[model samples]
Target: MGKILGIGLWVCIVTLGAVYGSIYLATAPAGPSEEDAKKAALELIRGEPITIPVIGGGDVTGYFLTRISFMMDKEKVKGQTLPTTELMTDQLFTLLVGNKMVDIGNVSSFDVNDFREKIKTEMNARLGEGMVDQVLIEQLDYVSKEAARKSADGGSRPMETTTVVEGEKLDEQPASSGH
Candidate 1:
């Protein structure tokens, strides 16, 4: 009877611990506010025409130049349009391209969350205590129009290559070979 009570107590303690742990993990606080986002956006735009590079391999050349518009509190601001413009031959644009190429070299994927966080960090650095409501990519694409035209003519870019194998074939050959 004593052993049974000990086991029951142990089980109860473990269950309570698990419940609390799950609750703690589920309710983590979110970062920043809409007001903060707007402030950050405004601060970032002050240095306007921020260009970032789109990194790729093999026959891909060039970077992306981004022009920041305004930063408004998501909850407070109503009906805003993002800005867009063709690649320009401006000094700021050139600096943006160079900085982006050095910063995001050979990156294959662009996660939106990661970009937003980066923008937030940058804004914080530029405007101490002020935060941007959001980082709107307003315009994002490869900088090389020539490369884009070439890809269009080829029907597919180099990054689309993939290998496929059937389940039955996998059993007959090394898993690494796929067939």
Candidate 2:
């Protein structure tokens, strides 16, 4: 009886060891090494900056020359989750050009965080999910038509406005009914 009990105890210990070992292996963080992570970062797909002129600011007189970039995961491209690059850029162009992001009052009045979130959300939806990892504000410049014109060759138009998005127009808010 003593021999049997001793053997049973040994088996129980081994069983617990096996279970814990397996659990540890299964749950361990399996991220790549630092070198690999850096390599992946270096190889990330960076979308072109979407530059546009924002044209309405309550009483403010200048337009926001905004530029935004999207950094996407390469795996998205490999896994067929991201669409063609041209399509992505087109969609981004449409979003920026069609956005209701005029100055409102001044640079301080524009909610960059809100705009960023909206771009991320809507862009992902347009791309069919997981296409863009981040939407970065590469540049935001505010210049009045006059300033832009002055900066140019005294005659050329301030940077020509991009073509309107093919499928959509700038959304106009309905006039409020005076109470």
TM-score of each candidate?
Answer: 0.33, 0.51
Q: How many residue pairs clash in each candidate?
A: 9, 1
Candidate 2 per-residue lDDT over residues 1-179, each given as its tens digit: 99999999999999999999999988957878886785565223434444455544544344455445565555555555334455556776777663566444444566767877888888789765766666666555556666666767575555543222111122233321111
Q: How accurate is candidate 1 locally (lDDT)?
A: 0.43
Candidate lDDT values, in order? 0.43, 0.57
Candidate 2 segments exceeding 4 Å error: 1-43, 55-63, 79-85, 155-179
Off by over 4 Å in 1: 1-60, 70-108, 148-179
- lDDT of model 1 at position 65: 46
- Quote model 2's TM-score: 0.51
> Residue 83: error of model 1 in Å?
17
